[model samples]
Target chain A: QQQVKQSPQSLIVQKGGISIINCAYENTAFDYFPWYQQFPGKGPALLIAIRPDVSEKKEGRFTISFNKSAKQFSLHIMDSQPGDSATYFCAARVYTGTASKLTFGTGTRLQVTL
Target chain B: SAVISQKPSRDICQRGTSLTIQCQVDSQVTMMFWYRQQPGQSLTLIATANQGSEATYESGFVIDKFPISRPNLTFSTLTVSNMSPEDSSIYLCSVASGTNSYEQYFGPGTRLTVT
Candidate 1:
C-alpha cells in the first residue's frame, strides 16, 4: 500500500511564479513529513521537513504548509527558478519504534521555465 | 551531513551477468540502506545493512537476488545477481547522520541497464 500519494505527475511553471506540489498521507501515526529533491543521475536530497506540531515551516524560498487535521501537506517554491526543475518526492515516517521506515509518494517532476 | 560515493556510476550488463555496486561513506555510520528506483516509480527500500550482522531485506526483495555485504562501518556493497531486463533501475545507498534522527544522506545513484 502506498501510504503517501502525490498529485500532478508533472508540472511546468514560469520564472518568478509559484510552484506548488501537494501530498496526502493515509497513516495517521506518521508524525514526520519531509520533502526531497532529486536531479537526474543524482539521489534525492532532503530539502525541507516538518513535524505534526507545526502548521507551516519556511526555509528561504521553500515553504512546507502542513495541515494536521487533513493529513495533507504541500511544498511551495516562491520565485521559482529554472534551476529548481527536478523531481520532488514527499515522504512520511512514523516514530513509533526503532525500526521506522519511510513511506514515499510516487513523485512529481517540476519544470521551472525561464 | 555525511558524504557518500558510489562506484561505477552506472553500467549495462548482459543477461545472466551480475554487477556489484559499492558505496563508501566518509564517516562511520551505524546503518546503511539500499534503495531501488524503477522506471516511472518512486524509490523503494531494498534492505538495511548492519555492520556485524546479516542484512535485513524488505518485502519483495531476497538475499539471493540482491546480496549485500557490510565489511565495516563505512563501506558496503550490493550485488545484483543474474541480470534480467526487468532488473534495470537506479540503485542508491543512504546513511543517517547527526543527532541519531531519521534524516538521511544519499549518494549519487548508480544506473543499471540490463540487456
Candidate 2:
C-alpha cells in the first residue's frame, strides 16, 4: 500500500475563512499522520500531527481531524490568513525496525486572499 | 523539532557534472534521510543515512548514482553523480528524533537545476 492520496490539488479562499485539506491512506500500519506547510523556496515545516488513536487534535488555529477506521485525516485552518498561502503536504509515517520512513501526499497549493 | 540547514540553496549545473548537498542538524539526531522533490511533485525518499555505516537506499535508487555519507549523527551528505537534465530537482534532508521518533523535520532543501 504505502500510498497517501490527497485531494483538491489547489484551493482558493478568502481571508478569515476556513481552509480544509483532506488525505487518505491505504496502509494500515501508518501510525502517525503529519501535516506540513511549505513556502516558496523553503522547506516543509511541521504544522500539526495526529495519531491513529486520537480522533482530533487542535494546535492554535490549526487542527487535524483523523478517522481511524476510514483511514483518513484532514487539516483544517481556521481564520485562514493571506500569510498562510502556501503548499501543504500530508504524510504518513511507517516505522521500520531501524528507522521511520515517511510517505508524502501529492500536496495542495492554497491561496488565501483578502 | 530540530533545526536543520542545507548548503547551496540553489544551483545550476551542467550535464555530466555532479553536486553534493550537505545537511547539518543543530543537535544529535537518531536518524537522517535524503529526499528528492521534483518540480510540482511530492517528496521521494532516496535513502536513509545510518551513522557510521552505508546508507540504505530505496527502490529505483542506487548507491552509485546517489552516494550518501553519514560520518556522524548530526551530519550527512548526498551526492548526485553524472547528472542529466532530468536530474534537476530539490534535494532535502530530514531528521527524526524524540522518544517515540514519530515526527520528522525537513531542511530548507537545495534546489538543483541541471541543464
Candidate 3:
C-alpha cells in the first residue's frame, strides 16, 4: 500500500510563477513531513520539513503548508526559477523501535520555463 | 547537515559478480541507512546500519544478498552479492544529523550497472 500519495506526476510552470505540489498520507503515526529535491544523477537533498505541531513553515521562497487534521501537506515555491527544475519527493518518517524509517512519495517532476 | 561521500561512484559488473560500495561521513553519527533507487523508481530503504551490531534489513532484503558493515560511526560498506541485471541501480548511504536528527543527509550515490 502507498502510505503517501502525491499529485501531478509532472508539472510545468513559468518563471516567476507559483508552483504547487500536494501530498496526502494515511498513517497517523507519521509526525515528520519532509520534502526533498533531487537533480538527475544525484541523491535527494532535504529542502524543507515541518512537524505536525505547525500548520505552515516557510524558509525563503520554499514553504511547506501542512494540515494535521486532514493528514495532507503541500509544497509551494514562490517565484519559481529555471534552477528549481528538478524532481521533488514528499516523505514521512515513522519511528520504529530506536530508529525511524522514511517512506517517500512517488515524486513530482517540476519544470520551470523562462 | 553532514558531509557524506561514497566510493566507486559508479561501476559496471557482470552477472554473478559482487560489488562492495563504501560510504564515508565527515562526522560520526549513530544512525546510518542504506537505500537503493532503481530505474525510474523512488528510493527504497535496504537496511539500517548501526555500529557494533547486526544490520537490520527491511522486508524483501536479506543479509546474504546485501551484506552491510558498520564498523564505526563514520563509515559503512554494502556488498551486493551475485549481482544480476535487475540489481542495476543506484545505491545510496545516508546519515541522520542536525538538530532534529531525523532528517537524513545522503551521499552522491554509487551507480551500479550489472549485465
Model 2, span B1-115: residue lDDT tens: 7999999899999999999999999999878999999988899999988787789999999999999999988999999999999999999999987424988899999999999
Candidate 3 interface RMSD to the true structure? 2.4
| Candidate that scores best on TM-score | 2
Tell me the lDDT of model 1 at B82: 94
Please write out the lDDT profile of model 3 over residues A1-114, one tens digit for every residue: 538999879999999999999999999988899999999999899999999999999999999999999999999999999999999999998887778789999899999999
If ranked by lDDT, best first, what sequence of candidates would result?
2, 3, 1
Query: What's each prediction's TM-score?
Result: 0.95, 0.98, 0.97
State the DockQ of every prediction: 0.61, 0.71, 0.59
Clashes of each: 0, 0, 0
Question: Model 1 in CAPRI terms: which quality?
Answer: medium
How much lDDT does each candidate structure score? 0.90, 0.93, 0.92
Classify candidate 2 by CAPRI docking class.
Answer: medium
lDDT of 1 by residue, B66-97 (tens): 99999999999999999899999999998865
Q: What is the lDDT of residue A114 in candidate 3?
A: 98
Fraction of the real A/B interface contacts present in each candidate? 0.57, 0.71, 0.52
Q: Chain B alone: TM-score in each candidate? A: 0.95, 0.96, 0.95
In model 2, what lDDT does residue A39 have?
94
